[model samples]
Target: MPLIRVESLTKIYSSTKEGFAGIREVSFEVNEGEVVGVIGRSGCGKTTLLRCIAGFESSDSGKILLDGKSVSRPGPDRFMIFQGLDQLFPWLSLRGNLIFAMKTVNKDANMKELQRKAEYYLELVGLSEWGDCYPYQLSGGMKQRAFLARALSVNPRLLLLDEPFGSLDALGRKAMQDLLLRLWGKTGTTIILVTHDIDECIRLSDRILVFTKGTLKFNLINPLPRPRMSEDPAYMDFYGKISRILEKDANLKWANAVLR
Candidate 1:
């Protein structure tokens, strides 16, 4: 069964600057343990769809189901990691933050077990040595890793990532992508990643959902094999196809606006 099912989800915002903003009739499903990537240009409601799924924003219409149950509000079963590194608590050390998150959901969990799990996830994210370090003391990439660890420590059934690596440098982004793959392999947690990077989406996602003008334009499965290398001809070919689709959609929107 699908772990997450978003049916005819719609949201609209009224504002003086950008009138009638938000997603419309968006729908998709995320299978258990599947990695789905949502991609589009800015102002395309990619993040809106993600926020709706995370329960951070209420949709004007439709439904979101998780594990066969309706999701009307935020819960421990779903955890979100945003693009900003400031999501971490500055006063708390990395390990402390993880422990605190664990306690929030599993209040009766034993301290020793929580600490053990914290350490395990820290090690998994390659931050074992920095567990005692404060968030302010770490680099941006390290801070993101800590955030990922903290989110995983809660044992969430679904992980929501919104351009989690967008702030990092090229090298840092690549490293985090590999780190994310390793962690996903270890945890088998279902993930919905919203990103503007097409190559990044192709590299990490099992399926890619293309959003344009507040609607789903395409839902496609990644046909490339594991350990996808951009240099490969097949990988480049697939990337070109996706890029063309995005470009075509953008042109169509521009033409429509001009006609109006």
Candidate 2:
């Protein structure tokens, strides 16, 4: 069975004046340990779809099943890491956040065990030296790295990333992407990443989903090899395909506006 099954899911904003503001009857399945990337223009419902799966939003129709069980509320089983550097608690140290998360998921864990696990994850993200530092003490990239570590410390069955490095610069984003890939090898956690950057999507995803006007228009497998490079023929092929999808949608939107 698939790890996640989103069947004919629909979530429309409450106001009709918004004119198709949310996803409509989207359906897809993500297998265990698979990394699926969601890409689309702004307001294409990529984030909306992710929010529903994370149980942060309720769908108006259809359902989302995790391991065949319907999801209706947020739980440690599904952990989300967002783009904001403020995701960490300002008052808590980096290690404190991870330790707190470990305790939340496994109440039986003692303080000593929590400390050990926290340190391990901090080291995993290369933030071991900054464990005692507060969120404000770290750079944007470092905070994001710490956020990833906190999410992994919980050992969630599904890791939801909503443009997790959107706030970082180009070099920082690339570094985080590499760190994510390295961490993926160690944890083997299933991931659903929503991103607007097509190149980033291709580098991290095994399959990609393209949305347009809140509809899942393209569900494709990435054909590029690992250690992916922009110069590869297959890389260009995959990029062109995704680019065409978005470009066509943009053209149609422009034509519609002209008619209006």
Candidate 3:
């Protein structure tokens, strides 16, 4: 059975006028240890779909099942790392935030165990010595690293990334991609990343799911070799294909708007 199964998921938002459709008739399954990337233009329901899976937003119809159980609300089983740098608590130091999650997840956890887990995750994210630093004292990339550490510290079964690298510069973004790939390889956590960067998606995911106009347009299985490089011929080809597909979808949207 799939680790995560989303069946005919649909979400609609209330409005004074016509209701806004977030996602309509979307369905997909993510297997254990599989990393799937969702790519699409802005306002194409990619984030909305992720939000539904993460339990931050409810679906009007359909079901989200994790480990054969339905997900009705947010829980630690599925940990989400958002795009915003302010995801970390401004009032607390990195150590405090990490400790809070560890304690919440394992109320019986002693300070020693919590400290060990926090240190391990901080080292994993290359932020070992910054535990005492507050969110306001860190750079954008450092803040993201802290968030990653906090999420992984809980040992979640699934990791949900919502444009987690959107705020990073090119170099920082590349570093983060590499870090995530290594972590995924080590922990074998099922990850579902929602991103607009075709190159990034192609590099990190074993399979790419394209969301167009609130529905899954296509799913591509990338057989490209590992330790992916943007200059590699096969990788470049896959990237170009996805880029074209996205562009085609955008053009169609533009045309429809003109007609309206």
Candidate 4:
């Protein structure tokens, strides 16, 4: 059975005007230990779809079943790491931020166990020494690391990442992508990552779901081998195919913008 399933999922926002819809009939599934990417142009319901799976938004007409159980509210089984580092509490230290989730969910957690889990996750995200540091003292990447550590510390069965690296510059974003890939490999967590970056999607996902005009346009599976290189023949072929699809979807409007 799929780890998570979205069946005929649809969400519509309240509209004063007669003809505005949010998301219509978006559906997909992420199997156990699978990393899936949701790719689309901006305002195409990528983030909205992630929000629905995370239970941040209720669906208008469908069901979200995790391991065959219905999801109605936010739960620890599915954790979301949003696009902003501001999601982490500024006042809490990194360790405190991680421990807070444990304290909330595992009421019987003792100090030693909490510290052990926090340190384990911090080390997992390469932040072992920064546990006592506040969010303000860290750089943008460090703050993102803390956010990642906190999320991993929770040990959620499924992780929802909504453009988590969208704020970083080129190098920083690449590093975070590498880090995310490593974490996914080690933890074997089911993830649905929504990103505007097509290369990132192809590099990290087992499959890619293209969202367009509030619907799932297509699903592409990545059959390339591990440690994929940009120059690899198979990678280039898949990239070119996706580029053509996106280009057609763009209606040839950005003819000047080269996709490479």
Highest lDDT model number? 2
- Alpha-carbon error at 177 in model 2, in Å? 0.5
lDDT of 3 by residue, 1-260 (tens): 99999999998664336334478888889999999999998878888887888899988899999988999799989898876637777888898899998888888988998988888999999998999988888998888888888998899999999999998999999999999998898889899998999888988998999988787888888778788888898887888889888888776766989999
Candidate 1 C-alpha lDDT tens digits along 46-75: 788878888999999999999889998899
Angstrom error of the Cα, residue 95, model 2: value is: 0.6
All candidates' TM-scores? Answer: 0.94, 0.95, 0.93, 0.93
- Return the lDDT, model 2, position 213: 86
Show model 3 residue runs off by greater than 4 Å. 14-20, 252-260
Clashing pairs in 1: none
- TM-score of candidate 4 versus the correct structure, residues matched by position: 0.93
TM-score of 1: 0.94
**What tens-digit string does per-residue lDDT give for candidate 2 at 132-246?**
9999889888988999999999999999999998888999999999999999989999999999999999999999999998999989998877999999998998899999999
Q: In candidate 4, list every pair of residues with a backbone clash.
A: none
In candidate 4, what are the lDDT values of residues 1-260, reduced to their tens digit? 99998999989875445344578876778899999998887877887787888889998899999999999789999889886648777889899999998888888989899999999999998889999988889998988888888888888998899898888999999999999999988999888998988889998899999877677988889979878899999999998887777666663534656553
What is the Å distance of residue 196 in model 2 from its true position? 0.3
lDDT of 1: 0.90
Q: Is candidate 2 or candidate 4 better by lDDT?
A: 2
